[model samples]
Target: MATLLHQITIDAPASRIWEMLTSRLGLQAWWDGTVSIAGGDCWRLSSDDLESPVTLKVVEEEPDKSLEWLCVQGDPDWENTLVLWTLEKAKRGFTIRLEHRDWRLSEIDLAAENTRWGERLMKLRLQCHHNDDLPVNDDDLSVWT
Candidate 1:
């Protein structure tokens, strides 16, 4: 039950960042290609290789500022674990602060996950600010040595 926070800054506007955070369709690209937010409240996450019947709830939301949610039903340990994404516009670019509460993880896994997050945030900025028209080369598969 430790809170793990990570910060990622990208050269994109708050609106664009919000879209990638909230929209189901947009999230699919980065979140292993399976993201669903249905009935205006629920969050359904699944992977093509490891699908499950779990759904989360949106607890609070503020456009271009913050988005928070927690798993209300399945996976007790993961349930009620909150994900708070806060965005702040900077003089140069934008800063995204992620505060993950009530989530437990091993130190090695934590470092790996956060590194992946940083990479994804960088891709988000590139897709949003640089060129949405051009396709991104997303074939860099995750392989641990």
Candidate 2:
């Protein structure tokens, strides 16, 4: 399995970043998906790219420090995969470390997911720092529209 990692320091408090990581509204803003708390320790993330809702189980949550999730249901391609987000104090404010791991797929698929997540993180950074909701490009407007 392969892992993709991304790290960025945002100009925001850990509390704010944590909220954006854990809350439905915050996730929807950055992910450009239909996000809902399915129940305790579970969330449903739906997007046009997926044929069905993906149920993610909260694997770990460390307040303002870190959060991890395991994909429990939905697309076969994403099944059994993991996503982790870690936050740390930084000079600018806080640093976000993101990982999408356990890829049992083709290189092309993995690359696509990597790019998609990078774009999402950029939006997340913009939102936390400037409260901006504009898309980064015309083709990506669907994400913020």
Candidate 3:
């Protein structure tokens, strides 16, 4: 199994970022397509442009400190993977450390996934910084394969 990691510093407090991470509306702002809370710390993420219903279960949460999820169902390539977000105070605001672990895919797919996360994290930062909700438009790297 392989692990993919990404780190970004956003100009926002940890608490504020935490809200974006836990709330449905906040998720929709940064995530692709619609996000709905499916009860009991579970989330149903579906995109109109896409067909799969990604099921994410909150396995662990620590308020403004950390959030972890296990992909219980959805894309076969992503199933059983662990997604974690760790936030800490930085010189300016807060640093978001992201991790995607338990990758069982080809190296090419792994690289694409890394690029995808980089784009997603940038979108999250933009949403927090300039209040921009639009998705990141990176034509060169596509995560929707």
Which is the leading candidate under TM-score?
2
Model 2 is weakest, by summed lDDT over 10 consecutive residues, at 136-145
Q: All candidates' lDDT scores?
A: 0.65, 0.81, 0.79
Ranking by lDDT: 2, 3, 1
- How does each model score on TM-score? 0.73, 0.87, 0.84
Instruction: Return the clash pairs for model 1, or none.
Output: none
**What would the per-residue lDDT of candidate 1 be over residues 1-116, giving only the tens digit for each residue?**
67777787777777777767766645655666466554457767764332344466777888889888787765544567787889999876679898768767677756665665
Candidate 1 local Cα displacement, residue 24, angstroms: 1.3
Q: State the RMSD for candidate 2.
A: 7.1
Clash pairs, model 3 backbone:
none
Per-residue alpha-carbon lDDT of candidate 2 for residues 28-128, written as tens digits (9 for 90 to 100): 77887788777667788988777788999888887889888999999887788899999989988998999988989789988888888899999999878
Best of the two (2, 3) by lDDT: 2
Model 1 off-target regions past 4 Å? 48-54, 75-77, 133-145
Q: Could you give me the TM-score of model 2 versus the true structure?
A: 0.87
Error of 3 at 141 (Å): 33
lDDT of 3 by residue, 51-141 (tens): 4777889988888899899989887777899999999999999999999999998999899889878987998888788554434434211
